[model samples]
Target: MTESVMPTYGRLDVAFTRGEGVWLYDEQGEAYLDALSGIAVCNLGHCHPAVSRAIAEQAQILMHTSNVYQVPLQSLLATKLTELSGMSQAFFCNSGAEANETAIKIARKYGHSKGIDKPVIIVMDGSFHGRTMATLTATGNPKVHAGFEPLVPGFVRVPYNDIDALRMAVSHWPEAVAVMLEPVQGEGGVKVPAAEYLDEVRTLCTQRKLLMMLDEVQTGIGRTGEWFAFQHAENSLPDVLMLAKGLGNGMPIGACLISGAAVDLLEPGNHGSTFGGNPLACRAALAVINTIETNSLLAHVTLMNQQIVAAFEHALSGAEGVQFRSKGFMFGIELPIACTELVKQALAKKVLINVTADKVVRLLPPLIMSADEANKMVNIVSELVLAFLATQPKASVA
Candidate 1:
């Protein structure tokens, strides 16, 4: 904890020196089971050999050359992503925020193309987009907007998972250009919408001609048992699809993929990124995609999800004021009371976990996690949760 770095984050009193598949080692070389996976950035786990080797080889040969020059790796990466996502084109950047910023620009420009002077993108309440000014404004949490006043305009929000509210908002706003949201609201407490919600949204967007944009930064790249979360819905394809987190498997890269209405919205001068889709980053991303496909981790995630969910259900069946929900490796076990302290508690027990939206203990373990690791995580979390509940009054627990 040095004063040299900005104290923007309320960081825990621990630092890791290195990490492996699903484990991180501190200064003392103590191994800790990693369930968070760097907040879903390391879907293939830390320092995956394939991604690491690709990065190393590319760094040795050619790390970067301006986007002005044709980068073959970028084209290859885009081809693989398009093949997997059914999207037409991709614009790459450095993180999830930039990818989303690209989507917002496309929405506004798309609106302009349709003769709407001011475009509005429909966002959802309780959603977490990013920390950039525009993304923070797009985010649904007021805490994210407390100090950033006079927030970016032309964005409206409705309750998540409420299709009727979305319809009303869209109908009310004549200048609406697109609808942006996560398939599973990850930072919004792992809230999974109704099974057919995406299908319904696709229908509405098609009927209204609104560009359906999905911010799949957290739920994409096989985290949701599919290449992309939107793929879970039948015949549902987004006009704009944003991705980052797991795409590079730890390498910093973000992408905005376009299809249908969103294609060609941003012409040559509309937008660009300096380091976006560089040789090194794109190579790493390609390796990540290849590794995932080769390992068959998507199906593995489905199996492990079922296993982990059943294990928790059986373990906490008798517990009151507890709720468990999951989609793939994204697990949320919510308790009645706020348990933010459980992060340090789990850390003390040599495990990593995260808490979001106050009471929802979020677990995003590496997709490469084995059954033993999964069981270990569930046991530690369940024991800690039950113990925390025991200290509270039975009435308070609920």
Candidate 2:
């Protein structure tokens, strides 16, 4: 077959034709239990009726009108998002990268406003922001920055979950304007920081008057058992919050929200996206928010997170060198050895999963996943891990 698409991604051989709830169907009509939710993009599952209908209805009525005119749906979505996030304003874009880029711009501009000629936004080690030049430079992964040198300046690096390191960094760099990071470090092997980490960071940022930016691209939209991951921390509201992944439940949409110290940073003509916040996208996002609210999916996720984590703990209790962690539907199991092959093994079992950071099996099942489906996914994945471990040479436990 002649391949026209760019080989940017090392895609799997199988192609899915359709999806519903937590199940995906291949071209041959085989079912694969989806545990990754399109890398946490489809929170409500594939083809959710509300979101699909909203897109369809809006497509028939309007899809794009450019950012020159007022987009009512965009305004409505912004209002709803602000109400939910406690943010003062919202800027929309087409992907997580753009949202983070918007955030980076805000940080730099805010720094410039303070008369800092060169500004620096502190980022964390092992964090993944986006693929754009600025965002990829902001990201802490070497692989993302390998081929893109002469990288954008003004981003400093620090260790994740270390408040003292952040404090030291802030003190060392007097021109630092903001601290940007993920709540759970999604692509960083689902690393969850100390419970007080966010609160402490918030306090430090407040004391220093620096923007506390959170990249919730993979943790927002109820993925972390909260409306936003920052909500999990007591009184931790970021100056800048970026979201995308599950915002529109598979639709392409990203938002950079602002509050104190970060508001009004980007003036008109400073930044704009032609397709951002168009009617179709905003309509779908509205439906997603409405559906989540109506279904009480947030509470459901909280409960399900408890249940699934307990299940994983019990299933892998005696497994050597295995550690499990989760926040809401974001699950990670770190094995003793490199287990990238487990992705292919799970696919053979008609279960879809992802391996990040070489050893962590990252699972992001849909929020609408049924208890039965959840149990099935757990069983399949647990069995696969056990079988794979049994084949490997046993290592001594500490």
* TM-score of each predicted structure versus truth: 0.99, 0.98
| C-alpha RMSD by candidate, in order | 0.7, 1.1
* Candidate 1, superposed: residue stretches over 4 Å from native: none
Candidate 1: residue 95 Cα off by (Å):
0.5
Clashing residue pairs, backbone N/CA/C < 3 A, model 2: none
Model 1 lDDT-worst window of ten:
389-398
Error of 2 at 44 (Å): 0.3
- Expressed as tens digits, the lDDT of each residue in 1-398 for candidate 1 is 99999999999999999999999999999999999999999998889998898899999999999989999999999999999999999999999999999999999999999999999999999998999988999999999999989899999999999999999998999999899999999999999999899988888899999999999999999998999988888977999999999998888999999999999779898999999999999999999999999999999999999999999999999889799999999999989999999999999999999999999999999999999999999999999998888888877775
lDDT of 1 at 232: 83
Say which candidate scores most in TM-score: 1
In candidate 1, residue 376 scores what lDDT?
95
Whole-model lDDT values for every prediction: 0.94, 0.94
Looking at model 1, the pairs that clash are none
